[model samples]
Target: MTKRSSPAKTGPQHLVLLAIDLLDSSLHYPGDHPPFESFHFDIHITSKAEDEKSQVLVTVKIGVHNENITRQLGSLTINCTFTMNNFADVVRLNADGQPDMPDDLIETLHSTALSTARGVMFATFRGTFLHHAILPLIAPGSVTEEKRL
Candidate 1:
């Protein structure tokens, strides 16, 4: 697992969902259909803090793959923008002027965004062959650990 940005840990921050956007989505099948042996998930989380606006934009992408992981069965990318109440406290400007956020805060936001995407993905492929290929319930740390910004 790739490490997340290890910035100074700030106290808890209140967040509200500002918006949810479906950035991209697609579904495919390689002859053999659902009820397959197994399914794999590829989850990626990335965030950008808007200190001036006291908001953070997080994108969570959930991709489903076949048992062997050779072919992609479906994918859903959702971008969620959240308004952080204590933006200044939890966010700090790095040397490069990028907003450095705490791991805990990021992990929480990632988890929420992932859950939202999961529901959307499920509804999207409903009644289709990919219906059975649902995004697995993933730990917050495990999801954000893969990638972060």
Candidate 2:
């Protein structure tokens, strides 16, 4: 059965960020093109749980593309590992016997990971052609909708 027992207010105290790693990133500008008139962002999120170790890894990948999206301006991929003190209690097997994660808990992790990527993107793109192109504040619900895993 799906576990819905996790408290809605799963605060930061229950989750500890163990690490943040820049799995990949790239910046490229077609030299002759006019300064990006406008750009779009493509974001992807995925999560893996190691319940035995009370750890969860959330991966956030963002891509910056030109107005037409025919070309990619830049991209960033970040992986965040978090430790939950109540992992066993929070994550439980669903009716299918597959691990089921609480929505609140998943949102929390995705938010944090995305925010971290935003900051890192700013720093990494600083002094570059895409310097002014910053990641906007994303609602967790919108972000979670893109999650594939």
Candidate 3:
């Protein structure tokens, strides 16, 4: 008789929230002039678990300005929220149960945006794991705009 071995199981509970932060920078339009200003982005990342269908939610807030006029004629604000699924598939697990990021996942996140809107924005984001035990990431805030052109 021969003995049979079973495959190792990777569960969802092993996932953890690593780092969350925003990259805010202004872009100037036309040589040395702030004609059009734009705020960069915000990102939240989580450690990948064993589930291949696990999803992660990312929320974004943007501020826009049109400096073509002199009296702050107009401004725009945008709020965006998106979900990235199958993130766990981009996580590599070592023998010690540590999570490692895959190149594909980084690429996907770098080029992903949730939604966009115009004029002072506020938003709340949440992520639900299907058939798994995972908590959603939530951010509640109001983005305000004040400019004097």
Candidate 4:
């Protein structure tokens, strides 16, 4: 899960005809029990949408570590390519007022891609990561941020 949160969009009246894929994912290490103390994430997209049909390549990299600063606990890298038709309203514009892909919407799609990638990653290390690492992070009845992910 990410440290930051994005408000969920429900009853959406904008955007349609979305398609996404997970292209690649790699894991450096699965980490030990209690997993890593922190993680690192990188996300980006390469777009080609001249006719409003966009093909985007999204990537996500996660580096995991524990209290030990020098050694890395684990890492995950993922790549995805998706095509979608951007709604007129959500599209960002250029200097000349010409329409372009919205960076924010692209970012939102990146999260969706990562979510699928993360699901696969967690399933890959079901015994180690799921049981020893992620499950322990949950502390019930604690006042915390919204639980949506």
Candidate 5:
């Protein structure tokens, strides 16, 4: 028999956090384009708190997949933090001892979190990777691009 896993303590929130950050991004062109193929990538998120702020780490991994095998192009990651100024305002304790985050507040939090992540991305890309040979061809106009997936 298989045992079920326990639920998360805080559960899931409806208001998704749209954030972006770039960490140590690089370009590795095989001197030319490999082949016509679809792009595949994955995103990972983790959060931690230090002092008055909570650090949200977002990592993006990109790989090119051909008929034979998949090869990693590169990766971008952003290290950001969200400080809870008013914990009670952001998260309320319900009668059942569960945390209740309001819809409006959740939306606001999402925007702020995303902006914070983009800030680091902007700086790193402009300062470090702006003149990369293969960057301008594939890179977006802005650091954080808002596109429908």
Candidate 6:
């Protein structure tokens, strides 16, 4: 009888967690607009699992408060999970053909946050500032230096 060989293990040894806090003084346009002092915005990204079998999951949360309204605008949360393989592919290709590092990963996340905020601003506040003005300020930059071959 022939012996069967065991399958090789593949994937990230440990999960990575990234947190970014976005502050927007101009979340609402017009300084005279009702002040929302209790509003809070937070985003969390987690590399749940890595390997041939699974992808990472990212969770986002936004909270707002207004003492005058019936609804206090507690917290609005959204979760997005994407495959590691897909992420890897995008990071490899930038505007120019070059190999990018994990820093690119954060940039992608920042872009996603901006997009999400824009969608929410349009739907809820009917505002145009989040996308045009606020997002640009909070966008994350490349955190690490690229290695030379």
Best by TM-score: 2
Model 6 lDDT at residue 45: 33
Better of 1 and 2 by lDDT: 2
State in Å the error of residue 66, model 1.
Answer: 0.7
TM-score of 5: 0.39
**Candidate 3 per-residue lDDT over residues 1-149, each given as its tens digit:** 11113322332343333334333323223344432333323333323233333434333444333335333222222222322344343444554443444444433332332222211122211121111111222232222122112
Q: Tell me how many clashing residue pairs each candidate has.
A: 0, 0, 1, 3, 0, 0
Off by over 4 Å in 3: 1-53, 68-86, 92-100, 114-149
For residues 34-124, what per-residue lDDT tens digits would candidate 6 score against the true structure? 4444443444333232323344434444544444444434343444444544434332322232333365454665456446654544454
Worst 10 residues of 5 by lDDT: 133-142
Which residue ranges in model 5 land beyond 4 Å of their true spot? 1-21, 34-37, 53-69, 88-149
**Please, what is the TM-score per model?**
0.80, 0.81, 0.26, 0.46, 0.39, 0.39
Across 24-128, the per-residue lDDT of candidate 1 in tens digits comes to 999776775436666788878777766667777888877888766477878888889887667766766665555577777777888889889888898888997
Q: TM-score rank, highest first? A: 2, 1, 4, 5, 6, 3
Cα lDDT tens digits, model 2, 87-131, are 666666444444457687778888999899999999999998898
Q: After superposition, how far is residue 31 of candidate 1 from its true place, in Å?
A: 3.1
Residue 88 in candidate 3 has what lDDT? 41
- Model 1, position 140, has a per-residue lDDT of 73
Q: Which 10-residue window of candidate 2 scores lowest in summed lDDT?
A: 1-10
What CA root-mean-square deviation does each model show from the true structure?
Answer: 5.0, 3.7, 16.1, 10.2, 10.7, 13.0
Q: Candidate 2, overall lDDT?
A: 0.77
Maximum-lDDT candidate: 2
lDDT of 5 by residue, 80-147 (tens): 43334444234443443333454444334444444553454345434332222121122222223222
